[model samples]
Target: MLDVQSGGILLPVFDSVRALAFVGDLSMGQPTDHSLRTGWIAARIAEAAGLDASIGDTVREVALLRWSGCTANAAGFADVFGDDVAVRLAMLEARPGWAEAREAPGDAAALMRPLAQTHCEVSGEIARILGLSTSTETALRNIFETWDGAGLPASIAREEVPVPVFVVALAGDLEIFNRVYGLERALELIEQRSGKRYPAFLADVAARNARDWSCAMDEASLADFDAALITSGMRRDARAELIADVIDLKLPWMTGFSRAVAMTALACCARLGLDEAAQACIYRAGLIHGVGRAAVPNAVWNRPCALPAGAWERVRLVPYWTARAGKQTGTLREAAELASYAYERQDGSGYFRGADARALSLEAQILAASVAWVALRSTRPWRAALPSDAALQTLRHEVASGRLSGDVVDALIAEAGRSVGRPQKSATQNSLLSVRETEVLRAISRGASNKEAARELAISPSTVRTHVESVFRKLECSTRAAATLKASAMGLL
Candidate 1:
């Protein structure tokens, strides 16, 4: 299962570090080959530092995973930088002190302290779970550390740090900077930062061999990095599930949301008599469907009320990010596509592409229905859990309204019928929505006047007007008709 033929070289596909590096590359706003480049450079640095070749793979592993936790603290980063990817790219461009001194632009300690801690925690845990070396895990935990003990999460000073870890850190920066700038400028920057952020020795070696070292791994097609890793000997199959675990931790409430969705989606497919290949794809797709959630900030995702139009737009793009990252993992491409379609609706109002029912595949249809079924029964900040009957009514209502596929809905409802009360994962990230807001929006969509909406919702007319204004503003419309349209598009109705 690991072997894939790419450009006539048999390369292992999606091995742990290789797969994660692809996702990390996207999260860091670097190319998909970033991790591979860094790993190659780090291995060379290790060799030059007089380290033996026996543990060569460990050096590469550390480099590949240095930024593996990029997604874990993304919301915190986005909270300060507006766009997490942009902030990370900018942070990399400016070097070590940039965040606290300038890029943070807010309460740097308040925002960055937690983010730094989270990066180490998540990356270290992942390395441990993957059964990587104790040293590799240590290296990942200290990924942010500089030579002068300035890293956050922990500031373990020089001697406590392993030499290989230090070498890998320098290599990652060297590779990135070398790629962005020509070899000369890259060497100049490293020469400047020596003894401060990086050790002078590693910089000296990198500077001397800058040209050849930077281009050594370039001739190999990007697809072959996994092969090189596989040749180095690591397994690849369980990577999707492992990545799902990482994605699940992005939100406190969504701890096991993706696994639940995958399981439920598979039951729907199995009930409909789909093939095993189809079943496997949907299962994997469900596991990482919410990976995109990491790219969206908690400030928007954790709102206990309805989101404004701009926030909703950001919410819609979550699936796109997932698909983009997934595509980079060639082995997961199909599964990723299914995950991307997780939010599409039959009425053509769903986003990231707004693909209508005609454009959606059977897997997409089933995934969407399964996601909706799971979401409706899960509790959120805005409301109590919907009872089975109420959740079913809500789902059925969508099918009747031509917003979802009837066949897929029937299969999902059938699975629900067969299953007993199992714990549901948090269905959707909805701090950006309020139950009251949805109720009011639904009423308005049906052309209810403020007084009419108030009467229906058991609120005063003045209070209803306040909610109406809030809805109008959040949805970014000046009129009731536009609010109704936007709400329908957002599935708030």
Candidate 2:
């Protein structure tokens, strides 16, 4: 981890990148760290083929951020295909010309073009907002572009595609194939798709050296795999926290809920005798366990009345999304998995899986109790915040009735006495924005692309995109128009 601590805070480039990748995986219906593994493969192929270190680094960054825009265009996707995740998974599995068929409610081109464009634009905007290089932004915007001009929205062919984009694209498919099939099939598939999806040169390279990449993927741990992608610079942790900030905005009253849960989880960890790595995992997992909340619509979350049967199923998938995102995050997989059990009960009464005592781990039990503790203390639209004593009594009753574990509830209550506060942002964080998001919000107000704001600010286009993304998340607005209105009302502009 590159500390590059400015003032008192550790630069969070690492955490933000990995966490975003994890969330991005969930967005794409992939396991967490899908991008991370792709990045590692891309970098190695670049190095083995003797591409410069800069190209390798660019590929890594591009791969990490490839799906950051998945949520940006989610509403558009849902508008066409009801279930956004299901549609995306289908699209990923679809072969060439599959979209030509009328499988959806609307014309595929009409719906998909805008969605793909939004995906590209928002991703590029994020890169610009984060101050990444122009090339990085270009690669991100062109991630869907391919050799044969048959890709989404833009459809730029071969030479028009950025080099890093080429590498990351091939690497992504190879990772999917290699993981799903054996090494030989992964290599053969690369050969099959060479002319159309990826460059022939890249495919040949991946095919020839498939074993090495496959071996590394088979052996690497999340910690080991991540350590290799380090690029020297002042990386900030703002984006990492900002992602959680966005996810929490799903419900109007859920502000700061993730941070509170994270703090309580860490507090409970002290009593569990967990190792430092385990504790850190628990904390990160808590922070992002709600990342999937973005998939659930606000109407369902804010409904004062009971959800209809249809709405109930979507509600059930919320924790599934969290666990899915966490499972893809190589390093945080354990913690993410544990945190997903937050809504579970010791008896077969919890949601999603309805796991009982035999299924839930000690860490999962602790995390669930912590999440309940925070929810009880926090104000919800339906009720006033529970008094501490009342909350404890209620939790105890749940435990006695076989809903929650007695040991976990008791430990959580005991941990409550040693109260801790949420982590604070540094005063040195960007000034005009007060929230690194304001810049992106302002850009949206002006109707600028990531490229436009990057030119004006003289920063990388990627940085602008990243900031705009953060703004959308922090403000909880989906469109530029909505974001602009929210910003003005809040006096952010």
Candidate 3:
């Protein structure tokens, strides 16, 4: 694998992307290895179809990342449909009544087109961020398109759609439908979608060999899929933030939640006199602690009233899923394990494993406390965000109740009180953006929509759009998440 240096440390591109893909699976309410299985199926299909070797590799990539854009439009899904996770799972499995539900409110095509556009754009940007081949990126941009020119964001169709797109689409269908319905039913359904979702020839290829492919996939190892990724790896400097950004997108109010927790945890680690290695572990854990959050539906998260017992049960399993997904990857195993403990209480009052203080490490204690602090300060649908002093009081209450460690709470509170100044104007002097563009960048980086940024700046939304386009051209980015990542890395925001 290639290496990219960040503060004199090497970051694995494959590891980071694979980790995000796991979260993507959770977002879609699927098992953690869904993408890996799809990738394997797509590669086999490509090879059997006598495609070029490079095209086969791209097919694998497109399959693995086909759902990477799910998180980008998660909130929109929640708005249109009550439970984003359940709706998406039904959609993918082609369950009865899903189409009716999608069209219940209004025109499904009109409602879905914008959401699809956002998903495609963000996913394509993710491919660009990983420095994947242009072909892979292009294929991903049209991931939802179909052979009949009827797909969402349907700008291209038929021969204009890349071969990898159709291959991956058929492979994904084989993987999901076959597993959900038996092999015969899966084949029947695929046949029904032929000449619509994909070409009839591709459906014929999959139907004839799906059973063998499914058996082979069941026997294949994770190593087999990762082998291709390692050989064609691309490195990047800011992979962790990519995950945090996508995770937060499930809820608009939760933008940058993980990064805030990580930064706070890092400061608390320093205040607690932890070693550098321990501090780094805590920081990374904070960034990914909410990976399990993806498994919980946005509707559940944004509930306006207290969750019922059943909903609470689902919420409690959030960390369980995080820990389970962690074991699927090597590089992220340790951090993900620690992240899974974010909710564990010192008094054995927390969820999903409910280990008491004696079972918790200091790093886990710090991470948990940091998550609590950040959540208390962030606004939620059920309650207004607590002020800093009030949030600190809540933490102290947890400490008094023997649920949080007093030492960790004190360290976090100390870090919270510390002040720092922003980088000087010189930091942006070389960014080559005008003052207005910089303002727009900073606003959007903070999760402001174009209209919100325009409202804040007392300008029209159209003007905001113009500035956003200009910013994209100047920064060479296509999505707000990408621009935000680049701006943060460059200290321009």
Candidate 4:
């Protein structure tokens, strides 16, 4: 069932993750729905092949996570390949001979050498940071390893490799060929590569399971699978926060990024003396502002070349999704509307519903400045992270161009300086509520019942209930944890 609270629709975290993976696959050079569809296919194959449920679950996980590390070195890729998106698409189509051709002892070799090195190192780093299980980590590291030990660093041979890695790689390639070529051609290619680049047994398994694979490819079923896999929680608010983290994980440089932006927005709101409810809304909205990026392809996002018109249109849809995701939630609607204008220029140029300064909300204006500042500091395929001075200069340029408000820019610069001196705190602080209400809300945020909150706080269950009710009323909230997030944004607790 769709979870709804206070007229807010909350997508489950796993469902949200599936949405993210779908977005990543479509946006990046990987095949469309490749990871997720492959995951569904692998799960079915494992079931039919008599694997245990645990093994099937692991296979599914490995398939989803296998290519997650690809974005870690986007900046390096942009540097070596000129256009990161184009390079990835080419890599997808590169034959073994073509790959080797790029390494033939000259400028080509020098260029492709860094690309390969970055791919391996960045993949490993991303896997480690995401806290994948040891087995999952091993699978990601050896994903490019060939049966002949000709693939990449460490080049481990056939029998030494993990089974999930082998299965995932086969699934990924087969899906691509099936989409680009035909089903028959895909089968022929897999059959041809059996016992060479791919394991003979896995290839045979894929061929035998091709029909079932197609059955699993039904878009409706994939959506159901997403719903089934979502992490369970009491309210959508908790789920939303988890979704934010997953989205941020798409690129290594963006870890905890949305939270940072949200916090800064809240701080700015405080400095400006906005009301507590509006401040809370700004904080939550900031954390979710980049949710639309999931819909864009990784190639376009990391592209070094200027985007073509159609691709640029897709890029603009990101803000639309951000607003769309939050529109059903009353508390988040205003923030989402504001965030939709996050990319707007002070002079009126922006996208997905562009509005100039007169049309911009204060929260949106603040968000625009914060997002730009963070992007400047984050490594991208086109450029290295700028120094603070350079980032400031860029911000100043935007101001000059009327792309950003000068007041907003100045506030962000001040916030950036302050951030450097202090250890970063939780983006949502529990300060919006009073002490008693905060205590109740915190317990509620942890999924505590009124009775549970009372025991934790050493107060009567009735008193706890009253405080919970008060928190809801005071923060214009209907749920315990949303109130907690409000408190955090306000730094009251």
Candidate 1 Cα outliers beyond 4 Å, as residue runs: 1-14, 75-85, 95-114, 179-182, 215-220, 231-233, 236-239, 303-314, 380-385, 421-493
Cα lDDT of model 2 by residue, 184-250, tens digit:
8777777878888877887888887888668767799877776877565315433344455445433
Sort by TM-score, best first.
Answer: 3, 1, 2, 4
lDDT by residue (tens digit), candidate 3, 445-491: 65578898999899999999999999899877777755665565444
Worst 10 residues of 2 by lDDT: 1-10
By descending lDDT, how would the candidates be arranged?
A: 3, 1, 2, 4
Give model 4's TM-score versus the native structure. 0.61
- Taking every candidate in turn, the Cα RMSD to the unseen true structure, in Å, is 12.7, 9.3, 3.4, 14.6
How much does candidate 3 score in TM-score? Answer: 0.90
Instruction: Count the clashes in each prediction.
Output: 2, 20, 0, 16
Q: Estimate the TM-score of every prediction.
A: 0.74, 0.61, 0.90, 0.61
Cα miss at 304, model 2 (Å)?
11
Total clashes in model 2, counting residue pairs 3 or more apart in sequence or in different chains: 20
Candidate 1: deviation at residue 281, Å? 1.5
- What's model 1's lDDT at 98? 51
lDDT of each: 0.70, 0.69, 0.80, 0.62
Model 2, CA-based lDDT:
0.69
> Distance (Å) between predicted and true CA of 378, model 4?
9.1
